[model samples]
Target: MFIVMVAPECAPVAKAGGLGDVVFGLSHELEIRGHAVEIVLPKYAGMRYEDVWDLQPSHHDLWVPWYDGTVHCTVWFGYVHGRKCFFIEPHSQDNFFGRERMYGYDDDALRYAFFCKAALEYLAASGKRPEVVHCHDWHTGLLPVLLYEQYAQVLGDQRVCYTIHNFCHQGLTSPEVLWATRLGRVDHFLAQDRLGDDTHHGAVNPMKGGVVYANFVTTVSDTHAAEARYGDSACGLGHTLHRYQDKFGGVLNGVDYDVWNPETDPYIPAPYSASTIERKYLNKEALRERFMLRKSWSPLVAYVGRVDEQKGMHLVHHALFRTLAAGGQFVLMGQEQKHNGINGHFQHLKDHLNNNPDSHLELSYQEELAHLVLAGADLLVVPSLFEPCGLIPLMAMRYGTVPVVRATGGMRDTVFDRDHGEHADDRRNGYVFQHTDNQAIDSALQRAFGLWTDYPEDFRSLMLNGMRADHSWHRPADHYLDIYEHIRHK
Candidate 1:
């Protein structure tokens, strides 16, 4: 199968979050399985060029239709992680992708809309009819729409598999922007069943269009899929997902074990596997010294993610104090968007906890430090109000760190509670909770702490259960290949 992934980000090159990691990991695994895989991404100014091999221009002039005019783009080719990649660099006065960041701009909807059209234009010009043109997140949401509506003849019979990483970001923009796609009859797109935004009237939703027009739609986990279809997580698109339930489903995202394996991770001070689990304590000691935490044998609890409300920051704040009160140590490494005012809140917490020797807060994300925190921590907490598919818990579990997560999204799929799961004795890997309140998270944490403090052998067995579990991309990639084959036959 010839598969082409059109996404806004890909890891080790232009990564903003897990969306990038999935694109890279899934594509690499597919290529390894004897399939031709190619990735198309915007040539963002801030990409890590060092990771791209044989970087050169592929097409000198490719014209893309824009609102009221056409934009000329230069397509560059390179090899990223041994996978063929194409980067579209637009030559225009708007400087669409020349910004310092990959996303979060005033004109994000328009920029990605233009990118969607440009990606299809490149595919049509290259004469490639891939079996699957997998689109990731809202960034490339317009691709499926444009592929079926505008470039159908040129790009013949390309089955689109649109994966919504998070439904919160639905790429809502004015219906007028539909002109840029050169899609015939803009009024047709304004219909409620097509691209219309359900919540914001007189607006178009590219993600909605993908859900409606694609051959198949998938989220990151089965629980998240149910949440989007029957719950409130779809951000007004639950009805749309319900209408397309026959074509929509979920495939749990996988971690790149090559980068996250504790046995070979160079970022940590000590390398240990499940068999050599005792050596993991050396990393715990090194982490305590590095974070300036008081020397003790208490469990080191860590949180590594964004300091945002969606992450249940309030729960994280409450958990920190509760963990300390329970005679445990807490370490946090996360960053918050300045506009959200959560950064100041975490900063105040940092100041308040300054005199406390059992807590440390670093208000920014450092890749190497994240690896160290995951390696050295005895317990990892992710109390998200709603998580689509969290890779942090998977990574923490891979490192033999017990995860205490709310039962939502992929966390529910991956981390079964040590005592509450159906097959607890066999499938139990971590602690689980249900509600978003402080008490719910605290209850789960107290259970984890109790086991860690009293039943040392049980705790070791729990950690070993997580370490021995397979969370690699091999299974997820195979699942995706099945979806591609199913769609092609349809």
Candidate 2:
């Protein structure tokens, strides 16, 4: 299968969110399954040449909106994880992706609009008309629109599949965007709702436009797919998804085994497996030492990811107060993003725990240190308000650490409840909370704490079970191939 993945982020090159993890992980898994999979992402200023392999050149045209000047970007290619990926070298001002953050730039809409144009231009220039061009998130949402309006005329049957990692990011642009592309046949009809038609709240919605144009629409998770059609989760864009429900579906993201392997992890103090469960304790001790804490603790619960409110940071923060009060220790290894628009309640938790000694909150972010914490921690926390498909819990489980997560989206599909246990300590994978309240999180924590405090034997067995579980992308990638095949045929 000659399939191509078009996303804005990729691992070891340009990454900030789970989207990078999805691209690199899924591409590798698909390639391993004997599928010719390639990824297309922007070559941000942060790219490292040494991280990429088999470098090659492919020309592309990037049109600058404000000026009539043409920015001819040199499209570079390198193989990562046995999958070829394309990077557009801006060559122009390079100010488009000069900043660190992936989103929220002053002219991100313009930058991404240029990128979408470059992607289409590159596809035609490179002469690689793939069977399927799977576009992820709004970053590459315009690909479907371009394919249908322009490219489809030339390349008759190149099926396009646009996967929405988050529908919240609707790439809205105006008629100026069309002019910026040098597209002569600009239709005023496209400015409407169905075909980039209606201007959204005065502007336009590019993500929604892709939804209406793309042959198929896939969210990150099934639960979120249904919820997105009509709920607060949609961020006021659920109606578009509901209208296109026949074409919309969900495809869960997968964790890359190579990136999160316990056997050869350079970050952990000592690598151990399910058979050698005793070695995991050394990692726990080392993690405590790294954080400058006492080695002897009841049960060390850890949270290691973005400190955003959507990740249920407040619930974890609230849980910490009770966790310490109940004679347990809590460790956090991620920084919070300041200045929230509508969802910024986690700041309250941070403010409340400023002078508090019991709550050990470290305001930092380190990948190496995170790997150590995952290997060492007795329990991992994932209290997301609504996760499309989280990878932290899956990473935690890989290192023999039990995951206590909120029951929603991928969590529901991945993490089994306590009742599924074959033994008293049989449900050792960790705890689960369904509701998005403080009580629900606390209830799950209590369950995890009780098992660690009283049932030492059961806890060890559970950790072993978690370590033994295979959350790798191999199986999930095969599932993705199935989806791809279906998408291609449809």
- The global C-alpha lDDT for each of the candidates, from Candidate 1 onward, is 0.90, 0.74
Q: Residues 133-193, candidate 1, lDDT per residue (tens digit)?
A: 9999988888988888788888888899999999988889886677666674767888998
Off by over 4 Å in 2: 48-50, 53-67, 173-175, 182-199, 341-360, 419-428
> What residue runs in model 1 are displaced by over 4 Å at the alpha carbon?
none
Report how far residue 469 has shifted in candidate 1, in Å: 0.8
Q: List the residue pairs that clash in candidate 1.
A: none
RMSD values, in order shown: 1.5, 3.3
Instruction: List the candidates' TM-scores in order.
Output: 0.97, 0.89
* Most TM-score-accurate candidate: 1
Query: Per model, how many backbone clashes are there?
Result: 0, 6
Clashing pairs in model 2? 171-206, 191-197, 192-197, 192-198, 193-197, 193-198
Q: TM-score of model 2 relative to the true fold?
A: 0.89
